[model samples]
Target: MSPKKLFARSAAMIALTTASFSTFAEEVNIYSFRQAFLIEPIMEKFTEQTGIKVNILFANKGLIERVKREGELSPADVVLTTDISRLVSLTSQDLTQPIQSEKLNSNIPSQYRDPENQWFALTTRVRNIYSSSERIGPVDITYQDLAKPEFKGKICTRSGKHPYNVSLVASVIAHEGEANAKVWLESVKANLARKPQGNDRAQVKAVKDGLCDYALGNNYYLGKMLADPKQVSWAEAVNINFPNQNTTGSHVNVSGVVLTKYAPNKANAIKLIEFLSDDVAQQMYAEVNYEYPVKVSVQPSKLVASWGQFKADTLPLAEIAKQHQAAVKLLDEVKFDL
Candidate 1:
């Protein structure tokens, strides 16, 4: 070939290579409600395996509205959050797409994943109660027992309106029906030492302050308290109890993800979801956050298993999604404020 022609071809090839590299450097934007520290390791692993950078926008609130406002211009390729109701809201609003992956199907149980596959449970946590070891004699067991007259003015919980508590209420309504659940909530509320005004961790703090005998909380708070050197005393003050073991077992919730309906990189999104569902990634999620791995084969961390095996209410989580409206109504009817 002529020298001039060869030079021209080489210049074009170099230009194309540079352009491709620039595009490759761009990140996969994610709207995640999870704190970065909790999920950053998994993101790093994903980047290492696929060379696709992840840019997370983490917030505790307003994320859903932000995504909706972005409309067709939204840059998010995925959304990850910590509850079924939130995921269902996204799905019902047409914000996400149903995804299919053999690995995800095999790893996550059918009951935990959406029947239509719009979202999936990446990990789970059981809602349980913790009590002051010294103050509460004879260690009360079931969630129902908290409402007994004996425990009045000695209980602590986060606001009833919080999604965690709301979902728990919804689960009760599902199992025991609205009338009974309302009565239980009323009795339980009467037992509160103070008006519900704090987050779960704060309830643990209240327990330490001698303001309450028991605090309703998810299991991770205990793990987090134990893992933190500063919070060791708080952990010491509270004894974890897996509630309702004699009957319905503890209430469970999840941290899950869904594919954006208009994801610019749909194929890559599915690949990412499937990768997160795999046992390896699932285990990392569980360990990092003290959540239960969605993969059945992965064992719970020693700390979690030490609480003892308890039957989880096997009610399909999607039912909770469908009943979210009813849950909200009941929360209002019961005057559970935050």
Candidate 2:
């Protein structure tokens, strides 16, 4: 071939290679347990500001198993999930890698992140008690109060095995010890208005229907319920109460993010995590989902703020993660869902 032709061919190859490299460098992939609608806006904002493209694969379950199956070949760069159980599962299964980011450490409180930096919470929600507006009125309550005999046949909740309830039970075990936690679990079960059934919103609906006088639920669900036209009345029928303000404080759980063990875009993944922890994304979380921001400087949305502030238990999430299995065991021992 002539020298000119060879030069032209080399130029074409160079352009193709550079294009591929640019595409590879500018994108990050996420395996998310959060629904797309709930997080997509913040991700879009991140992409808009940083010029890095975001790709998300959303699912309600099985993401951990999927990543395990994919192994080192996994395309996942980040994993976003709710509850400490899922976070602990990722670390315990060796599906995540520890990250050391000054930005993350500074933005997130120590209690809300893994000590080893394997996972970081982006948002928190209280495991709150909802009382009938007409029947109970606004009242101070505690986790221990639900077990009192007067509350028998007056309380409603989702299944105890659910991550939210499991985490709440784990917090109890952390504070009250395994033996006492079991007693608490048995008593709470005995007090159930009916066998534990349905999601947190359903429990609130039962309250509206007068099937129960009180229900246990995550705080954000109140925002969600009120926003949804069909569910608005359910939310209106009850007042959200943060439990244990005078004692151990409300049990708080988080929706958090982790860097994958074999992230194909590690730098971009870290950037995304940091972005989520920053004020922009944190504010979106507060406004859109009615969750408490993990960043200390960011405040809750006006509506969420209207619920009235109360103390959140300062127990480190690591301790709650440690007691997770024992919490599940206690639930089973007492046949909590049965």
Candidate 3:
């Protein structure tokens, strides 16, 4: 073969390989505690924009422990969590790295992100009160108000140790002192219609079944139930009430993300996180999952909006997270589940 022909062939092969790499640059592996359906769309959009595929491993528990066990060899690029405490837990374990991204910083409000930039809340869910339509009329209630004498034997909830309830309880500890929060938990526990059992939707169902008149549950579960054909009736029997609008604002928890300590594809992972915080992804979070966007510019879904607005507590997530152990201990102290 001639020298010119060989040189030309080599250049063509090099260009082809480079273009192939550019076309599918990398894949970002996510260890997500969030349900697959809730976040898959946002990830699809990220891939569409950046050409970086997302690989998600979704589970109900133990993702953080898995990451810790894997250590530096962990393939996780980002850890996606449905609650603020896990994000803080991942950070506390030194399993995540601080990211300094202006895009991330600007997109997520300071109130909804880590002071050190280790975790960025993509969306927020309100732990709302579901009141029986037949028993309770349009009523204004607060989280603190539920513990009053009149509400005894009127509340339904899941196991108090569940992350959702713990986060809410932790928020209480944040807003009030630990002693006051403990007393309040005891009062609320005394109000339970039965021993704490079932998921959030069951609490709503319990209201419909007349098992209880008021249930503690996350606001988004109402949307989940509304979409389920069989559970639609259970959903219709309750009114979504964002409690504490009159005081310290509604107790809100976050679904957040962290940059893992062993992110092999760090650049691609950062792009995915940036995409999630952008206006488009924020809109998807509200529309797809009925959660509030962390971005101030993005509006909540119409259904979520129709529930009307409530002031979201601005307490830093870290503050609430710090109280998680105390919340759990108090639940055990009160035997809230029993």
Candidate 4:
């Protein structure tokens, strides 16, 4: 089904469900770019504990546009999405309202949230470099190393336009400045094993199949690949290396939430957002989605924990967001994907 049709159907279903409930039953509506499966369990637990009916419309894209079209009449209380870009889009478009919650402030670290509290990160994942176990074994590397002559024709990645890669490029711009980052991007383009193609997991599969010696992928994909029976070999064939450990450390990104500006159930929405930031929901995010919890008190699932800790770049996410446009322009300048 088209995303629009699917969104309409899902919204209708949610409306019916909400209407069937007792009139007094509190409810909150969500427009989410996140997959339903990853969040349903946590929502169910929240419903059980608070008796607030949760209505969700899940789409891979267009939630932001949909909310914009709905404007003041929008039923959406919250917007849930992955990546810093989407989170920034919410505030940039003026679709979200600032939230003031002591619980949220204490649970999420400053670096992971909007300074204005318009959005709060729920989970974080590292942008890791996966090295072929059979070819390269374990090695310490940095984003800068990917551009070196020694690694030419040895790396694989997704499209430069992909949010994950774009964010990585943006981070380079954030740390190295546009001129240096452009040069690095040009050299990295020269090093591509093939034109950048496929998702992060596909890059790992490329490494496993010996298409390349290295792949840039998110950290959670390794945990996910290990759990999938068909992909365990891909997981086994690579070592998850944290880049820039000796310097600025690995770049990290987040999945986050925003309260809509015209929420009909503001109180319940705040309650739900607070619940998501708390230990119970944060733990579910870690265990169920293979993501690292933003809540400092919550530890990662056992499998994710086994991948020893590493230093994450201290560059604020807002700093990375600032470089997004420059990063995209640099990618185009280098013709990185073509």
What range of 10 consecutive residues in model 4 has the weakest lDDT sum? Answer: 16-25
Provide the overall lDDT of each model, using Cα atoms, as 2-decimal numbers: 0.81, 0.91, 0.86, 0.90
Error of 1 at 212 (Å): 1.3
Candidate 2 structure quality by residue, lDDT tens digits, 123-168: 9999999999999988899999999999999999999999999999
Residue 290 shift from truth in candidate 1, angstroms: 1.1
Q: What shift in Å separates residue 20 of candidate 3 from its native position after superposition?
A: 19
What ranges in model 4 sit over 4 Å off?
A: 1-25
Off by over 4 Å in 3: 1-25
Model 4 residue 272 distance off true place after TM-score fit, in angstroms: 0.5
Candidate 4 clashing pairs, residues 3+ apart or interchain = none
RMSD of 2: 6.5
Candidate 3 least-lDDT 10 residues: 15-24
lDDT, candidate 2, residue 129? 95
* Greater-TM-score candidate between 2 and 3: 2
Q: Which structure is stronger by TM-score: 1 or 3?
A: 3
Q: Going through the candidates in order, what is the number of backbone clashes in each?
A: 0, 0, 0, 0
After aligning candidate 1 to the native by TM-score, how far in Å is the CA of 14 from where it should be?
A: 27
Model 3 lDDT per residue over 48-98, tens place: 887788877777888898789767656678988888888899999999999
TM-score of each: 0.89, 0.93, 0.91, 0.93
Model 1 ranges off by over 4 Å: 1-27, 137-140
The better-scoring model by lDDT among 1 and 4 is 4
Model 4's lDDT to the true fold? 0.90
